[model samples]
Target: MPDTAYNLTVGDFNCTVFSDGCLIDPDETFGLNCILIEAEGRKILIDNGFGENSTGTAGLLLDNMKTVGRKPEDIDTIIFDHGHIDHVCGTFKKDGSPVFPNARYIITREEWDYIKSPPGDNETQNGFYRHARQYLLPLHDRFDVVASDCEILSGITLVPAHGHTPGNVMVDLSSQGERLLCIGDIIHSPREFADPACLAAFDVTPAGAIKTRAKILADAARDGTFVFATHFTFPGLGYIRQINGVFSWAPI
Candidate 1:
């Protein structure tokens, strides 16, 4: 199980990246990274993470929360990058009540629609619909809708980057003129930092994902925006740099 959490601060906001755990197989692999942010007098948790129902190696965000002296009840808001199972299952507990009962939830309306009323014959969409039916559907009352590029708070905002899933988005954090973007599942492999067009096999819309990834890389470089890729190596925070016409990730 992942027992450590990475703590860092951006200007005035503090953030902790908690490992829910990882999934590895000969054929496929990925990691689960949930973030807890303390900003502007509010406690916000990003991505509910895989909960108790996940493999034994996961479901430890709450435990990690305690290690950092935070309790589930202390969180006042929860924001999601998308409605994927690994990103949202932790919002509910074994008996189905919300894990952080006091926190208000936010998700893009496109994502809200994708999960609440998934339409299509695609198997992957069907699977996500099933997961949403069990996890997010019951939390409707506490959920709020936001635009693709809406400000979430005084110094935080959500930006659209749809591809990995419909309505997928990234978060923007700014304070004291410093900027960072929590790029949700934008580029899982570091190699993609150099080749922004490469698409993950599971991307629901490969072309859209490619376009978004390219733009994120270009914009981050142009804007000096630090980046936090959800599945990047530990710490995950970094910046994009261009060297000899190729982009590389420079971890901070």
Candidate 2:
């Protein structure tokens, strides 16, 4: 098996980027990257990849974690960037039990509401929402929904960049002077880094996605901020570059 876990640090916090596996489609391939932040005494997991229910070459989060000496039960907090099935479905086991039983879940209030009352019925685009609810609703009372742009911890911040989903957010981590911005589903394909107009089909709000992508790509390039993308290549650690007025991705 290939190495799926990449360990690093964000200032004082120990961070690891785990590959939940990849989604290979006829036209494109997507890497599922999840982040684990060990801060103080907290074990924070950014997203749990597709669990048990996934079909093809995905759902490797649990095993990847195990290789790093971590387990589902060892997680103390699970912060969801959105309610997409691939990001939230791994919260439950095959028997419908919570995978991270000891962890408290956190998500933007806007996202939680969207999950409960999705855009349409099961037959429509709401199928993903319906599937997500099955794994999330059981832990309804365990979620601590907060407003967008909330600071999750001392160095971890949830920045609102809604577009792909009703309440999608980005994780911004700052420590000492170094910074890393985890743009969840913001630019699924590398080409989008240079062309913000290249929208993914799943983007619920294409206009918002384009606007947010443009802004983020510009800002990251200007500031030279390290970025972690959810669906980019494995480990997805890189810097956004801007020359003249064009943007591009520079993997490190």
Best by lDDT: 2
The CA lDDT at 54 in model 1 is: 79
Please name the candidate that would achieve the greatest TM-score relative to the true structure: 2
Q: Which pairs clash in the backbone of model 2? A: none
| lDDT measured at residue 35 in model 2 versus the true structure, 0 to 100 | 95
lDDT of 1: 0.80
What does the lDDT come to for candidate 2?
A: 0.85
lDDT of 2 by residue, 1-252 (tens): 347999988888889999999988787888899999998889999989888878868889999999978998899999999988888878987888888879999999888888787456435447667667776877888899998899989989999999878799999988888788999888888777565666456677778889888888888888888999999898999988889887777888
| lDDT score at residue 172, model 2, on the 0-100 scale | 90
Residue 42 CA displacement from its true place in model 2, Å: 0.5
Q: Which portions of model 2 show Cα errors greater than 4 Å?
A: 118-124, 194-197
Give each model a TM-score: 0.91, 0.94
